[model samples]
Target: MRKSQIRNPKHRTENCPLSPRLNYFRIFLTFARNSIVRDMTFRANFLIDCLSTITWSLMDLGFYIFVVFRQTSQIGRDTGWGEWEFYTFLATTKLINGLVQAFFMPNCEEVSELVRSGNFDFALLKPIDTQFLVSLRKIDWPALSHIGVGGILLSISLWHITQREIDPAQLTLLTGVAYIFYILCGVAILYSLMISLAATSIWLGRNESLYDFWFYITNFSRYPMEIYSGDVGTPLRWICTFIIPVLIVVNVPARILAQPLAAETPEARFLLFFTPAAAVACLAISRWVFYRALRSYRSASS
Candidate 1:
């Protein structure tokens, strides 16, 4: 048997009897367990990281409350995103961002380093799909603090909205199902963008600007897309909406929970339907880009 084949015995037909879907799921659970063990090994550091994340989330919420809400009742001029409603949107942002960071950020950030050190060769030789392995091999457990914080914030926000009778949308089982679905869609869109950027490391040789670029692009998603109206902002709205689709990441999901569809304009209604399609397209494009970049890779030995 060849060296590469021997190193990846899982690829051998006799070594793998389970169905592919089940096999991949088992592999993912193993990766997640290993990650948890690694995090627990550094318990102090993990605790500090979690505390810091929670602190930052609180500070951000406070900023919006003291600064932004002091002046206007709604996020934009008549956008219908009042204080608690906007908080719901903010909470959704945290949930989506938290999930992406916890599951994929660490792995994607390591891609360039792996390429620089020639360790990515082993990843390429793995029996499973390279994208799946590389994207999920390491989970940042501390970042899950954001999800916890977001959940608390969401519950609080929804409670306030209900008490004040401010929610434009009725809360129902179907509404919740749609909200969770779009939240996953938002995560998928962001992951695709991150992995696509990471893939460029193979061609760029070093992609040190990955995080900076990612921050800049995603910063737009932190706010309601309705705020990007008028001449100057309209162009940015168009670019981020149709071209990059970051505008829809948090917006559509938040709108599903915070605002009524009947109150939305025709354009807004159209975008709500378009978001799922955009997520699918982004995943396809990112997959193509990753494989294309992989073909350009040259091992250190070469």
Candidate 2:
């Protein structure tokens, strides 16, 4: 037998507790490095992928500038989501979505194929958590290019806001800190949602529509939630804000940095507190659902 096929017994001991957190971090780095090398080998494919992502993002921005921004100065009722402010919100959404797609989307989308081909059995034999191994095994470097575009958009918005004196007082040190923290929370919430959907593949056997379902659900999150606050959209706002919680992911961080609510208002206080709380709750629920799905998994050999 080739050495590559050999499994070192010392790699995993049955009596050992959970894998060391540091070991998981190292393993993740190894996976990312290998994926980068693989993508580099296909230089043409890599370039095409990168160009495609940048083109789509630019087109989306252009649509807003030429179409929507030309028609209205604000999205909400005098809430100040002007051209630059709304662009900042769009940039935040892109940054969050970019990270998720780069790190988790490829792996999550591959889950059904893994199960169907029995490749998941190898993942289960690994020392680390199966979900972690499966989710982080691949990184899409091209997808991450959106982060650069997002950063540029964000910088332009910040400069424009300062130059125009659009509530410059709201951009305080505290607000900056809160914005960063909530951006992280938003990312966490999105990751939780993606992984949970991926976990469903274990039971469904083949969930090829994962991307379609995910896009449909998260499409609502791309715009300002205030647009959904009218009589026709109030129920949607409630469901997304309280039940699903995806709307708050980008809204909180965007609002904090763009058009902040009055600190003295009850609604503002609720949103300020609810953003972090929702992150924690969503993560806990998703983790439970993932593990439960794993427990119910049955290998093809069985």
- Displacement of residue 28 (Cα, Å) in model 1 is 0.6
lDDT of 1 by residue, 197-300 (tens): 99999999999999999999999999998889889999999999989999999999888788755327798788868899999999999998998888788887
- Per-model lDDT: 0.89, 0.84
Which ranges of candidate 1 are over 4 A from the true structure? 1-15, 166-169, 261-264
- lDDT of candidate 2 over 177-262, digit per residue (tens): 98889988988888888889988999998888999999998998999887886787999999998998889989888887777654
- For candidate 2, the C-alpha RMSD (Å) to the true structure equals 4.6
How many angstroms is residue 190 displaced in model 1 relative to the true structure, after the best TM-score fit?
0.4
Return the lDDT, model 1, position 9: 49
Q: Which numbered prediction scores highest in lDDT against the true structure?
A: 1
